[model samples]
Target: MLLSAAARRRTPCPGGALLVVGDSPRVVVVGGGPGGYEAALVASQLGASVTVVERDGVGGSAVLTDVVPSKTLIATAEVMTLVDGSVELGVRFPGGAGAPTDPGLDRPGGAVTVDLGRVNERVRQLAAAQSGDVRERLRGEGVRVLSGTGRLAAPDRVVVDPADASADGPADGPADGSAGEELAADVVLVATGSYPRTLPDAEPDGERILTWKQLYRLQELPERLVVVGSGVTGAEFASAYDALGSDVVLVSSRDRVLPGEDVDAAEVIEDVFRRRGMTVLSRSRAQEVKRVGDGVVVALADGRTVEGSHCLLAVGSIPSTAGIGLEEAGVQLSESGHVEVDRVSRTSVRGVYAAGDCTGVLPLASVAAMQGRTAMRHALGDAVQPLKLRTVAANVFTAPEIATVGWSQAQIESGEAQGEVVKLPLVGNARAKMQGIHDGFVKLFCRTGSGTVIGGVVVAPRASELIFPVALAVEHRLTVDQVAQAYSVYPSLSGSLTEAARRLHKAPSVAG
Candidate 1:
């Protein structure tokens, strides 16, 4: 059993002679993603000799392929979107700004064009720089970094194989006389992360058909792009490509795009998507994608077909936990192959823990980092608190970004929570009005009894930045009145959050 924080401080380090007052435990972390590296750093700070084994470069997919690269692409798309509305804001350029009055050399060849090659090169450079930063930070903190695939040999030992070797090979074998190095550890953390899920019938050819990661490699944008799946990834890419001047068709297997997100936010975004001339095919499940003559065709479940210059599959992700010797060391995994971990990141096996997408927790990088810290604190016998995901802030990086934190409306409607909800449209916000932004809103949920702010959803330009205070309120359990009392700059989108909280606090409480 884990000791309480107070008890842990009083307890002496096991098998220690007080060399420097406490024992420095050895910690070995597998997969140098946000979760693994963050835990290594924290464990090192707590007097642990740490080692991180990574097959891929440091920062994992979050920096190298998924999060950072996608966001960079989104940033470019966002600029284009803003430029599209510049005319409405009274901004003028050569050729009379806004839409071109004439298509043929309108006002001496004045038009905006997205250079896919330059944008992709910049995205790759940024991702590489961030990965290098993570690598440098880890090494500077006295953590040993190994470029290899790591697997458990025993409860207290990890065997690392060369990156080129098959990870499924014998764990303890010195068969080829180059079986790789082994490291003994007092504790181990698994943060192998995940990979994009691809369908057998719809394989990405890295050209006309691509995954989210491969989209950045194109030299020229697709003339007409067909995006499969309308989840967060699909919606983001569809919105981005449309903004970047591509004829985008979004195929959803559900009733609407972003079906899993807040209904109102999804509706608003869908409206925006249609208004921007995107072809949204609801209840359309893509069965397969096949290459045609210089294009691709996406066959739907209902025997319909959509052809485009390119096809992108954004179904979901699968955890990278297979053939890593996890179960061999007695670690439990969910039926879906994700590590089964508790709130403190502990697995069923003693002295072993997991974090990030591999653990099937919230798939956000921020949540992964928090889980890593929690794992290290618990492992190093320091004061630690289990993670409460209710306060985690998540954002969908579409045109008008959607950000949400804390208790959702589903929780309230299901009778699991009782809260008063107040929604303030972004149209009412002075900054949004001035910017010619007419879509999106700020919705806040407050506990009915105590008026404590529970959750919130923000849908506006850069909603990711505006959702921070609501996250703070949820994390600190601040009351609606307390949140409302805070000062916000005039003519700002964030002021809407304060306004929503004020309204919630003023409303009568509803009993559960």
Candidate 2:
């Protein structure tokens, strides 16, 4: 049973720039994750009375178990790697009185060791803080935040059942059985993100067998961590754990790790992993993962077995769209069970839109936020530009992180796009020499004759930050000359980006 709209208490939106003549348009946003909460903010600004129904906390999985927590853990690993490598640059500890220290670039054997317990604690604290901050922000904007399971009664009506909880994120919030609240909405936005995919034979026990989300629960680091899957998630965990002084075994079904990423970037990361003594089992598919005593054993499809203290499954993720009452509302879903949405984040049904991982567009968080914002702009009758995937910047948070923007090399090779390419190794950069860095490169693409910046890839320490300029150029169709004209700090890794662009610069034609 749903409560009447007249009986519901509407949130008093604090500051709305857009003034409404009559009754403010009611917007019911389903999911409190990045897409859902972000849309709520936008809808509120547009003078729409917004109500967000979320099963988990305000920040969603990105803040709870996924992006925020994982990245915080990786930051510790990164500091260890940097300090361990800094020994070569004449930095010595108390024991080394006068002589140059041996940089353990091959493997980490320094006195510095990470406490997984402390690291996990910090990760959890940070995530909780972020979630709380988001909740307060939504409250400040007067967007009603309901912590309960939400379902569609119709395209424009949503019912929040406090008795039912959702499987979104890694939340275990207990539901209360109360008469649910009914929302009368002129528009509805669904931003329910995806959950980590699991195999029936290798179900996560959260002990020896775990998912990426459960990694933070571990007090002591695994003696030997076995990461199954060679994709972004698998590679990242493998890299981080290895740098954290754990013997890691990476199981991959493909020939090389990061099969979906850029080829050159994949090669650099794989080399780094192998050189650091991490065992990579390529073309090995795990058939089953089960506990045998204290440790876990993984049986491969090729009749081989690998044992480890813990196993982290990173196969992929499935969109959390089931049992949400989307189809009943005439919203068409894809064969993969993802909500089918257009450029403006519209579903097949009118007045109902979908975004984020649930739409199966792209798995990046930045992409999700853009999709959510675009959806609201269209819904509120504001001038809106459709979502442009090409302008979105993506990062792989590995050691010597890989970042990409716009066109990929494969698109050029396959004749799908016409562009000029230039590859510059970071070894030549002054910053690389000073920092004792020897691997990674910067690759840039541009229009053939016009020299317009089309795309770029950066591989280095914190490449995520370095790729933004390239993203800016690609989005605005800036020329190679324009990119080169922008000043980059000398003796810095970013200089390589402009240098790559400068290589593609063409001088003005003079009368012969």
Candidate 3:
């Protein structure tokens, strides 16, 4: 689904030497993921003829198997959670509690059943449709789409293998008859994303033992699910499956779930998971995984074993920077195989840029998009700015999402940041009480000397939405007192934002 177009808006040339009418600089983008397509569009807009070559759909992993699909499934699971309390809310179940009146104490069939086949089908359909829409949008923008695998043969040379083109065909043959066909580009942007990392002893069978990417192939909910790794993806799947009625076991190598997240947020989720019957095995490392009869067994490094109907490995992701001509082009790779780049996404080799997961920045779609645009600007000698992690906002998509922007509580507590801290619990919120909600809080950190908002965390349903205010405050350099004075709804969950800010304003003066 990678597409590129001729320039809709052209850049003026200084001497007209490189701006010849028939020889405009041709740029080829490899990968249809966020980084590739985004840059393709921008490069086209900057007067370069652009072409995007991709092996899969336009939206890449974020759209196809990860973000869009997982979020859609989460939305469905949320509705099921809401509907399960119909009786408690005084609403009749599909079959009234005692409609027959025969056996007053009779056990009813399942209150609701999820058609996994239909649900998965819908997930795939929506994902594919969205990918197609992106392709169409690129086409409308005049970008050409090439369905193929692309590789760099040299700094200014590329080879594309059309998905259906024969290996022996002239178009499929590289200029030197190398493995890949050879094409030329004035500049190359490597945006190939990544795949879910699999353990050496535990391989994904797309069934019993699976990676996060392969879980989309499942048509039936697992009776018992065991998730390995307590990272962002692992925690998200564990929380989501628990809400969807799976007996889940989360294995963590650290002392707590989401060890890298804010401690308070991690504790809140850990407590909720235990309360909800999710077996969280902290300080446990999965040494190996194997199939035992109809179930799977995860052998822990501590000699403990967990058996479950399905096992999901979310240890991490490995960049797809291999098998390309990255090394051949003098582009440096990190020790972990990531493309080594500076803040501007430039590789060691000039005219070569890498972005997104390949660059080892936070693997968020938003960050990937930003990196891509910045790379295009820099590559084309336009305006360029380095990536700023200080204002980046990342959200872990658990039940009560944990969203953090700027500095973390641990940073302040460890004296890494000179900031005052304030926290407001949701238990006292009138709207939260009305909605029968609890177990959430708003926390803020402000610079002690200047009172300028520095960082914050929000733990709540729709925390992703609520974190925007904190992100804005940090970006605009708003002071805690100014934030406290901002108007918030009288009886809304968002009121906690103002409350936290007010507390920050009351903190005693401190020195950096």
Candidate 3 overall Cα lDDT vs. reference?
0.79
Screening candidate 1 with a backbone cut-off below 3 angstroms (N, C-alpha, C), the clashing residue pairs are none
- 257-280: candidate 3 lDDT, tens digit per residue: 998899999999998778767899
- TM-score, per-candidate, Cα-based: 0.90, 0.92, 0.88
Which model scores highest in TM-score?
A: 2
Model 3 segments beyond 4 Å from truth?
1-23, 84-110, 162-181, 506-512
Q: Per-residue CA lDDT of candidate 1, range 1-512, in tens?
A: 32233332233332221112244677899988899889989988988888988876678778778898899999999988887777666566776545444221122223677999999889888887888888888888988888788899986788988775322111111211133788877789999999889888998888898888788788898999999999999999999998888999999999999988999999999988997789999999999999998999999999999999999999999999998899999999899999998888989887888999998889999989999998988877777788998989999999899999999988888889998888888878889888878889999998988999899999998999999999999999999899889999997888898888777766656999
lDDT of each: 0.84, 0.85, 0.79
Off by over 4 Å in 1: 1-23, 96-110, 164-179, 507-512
The TM-score of candidate 3 is: 0.88
The Cα RMSD in angstroms, rounded to one decimal, for candidate 2 relative to the true structure is 4.3
Candidate 2 structure quality by residue, lDDT tens digits, 173-276: 32232337887787899998988898789989888898887888888989999999989999999989988889999999999999998999999999988987
Candidate 2 lDDT score at position 162: 66
TM-score of 1: 0.90
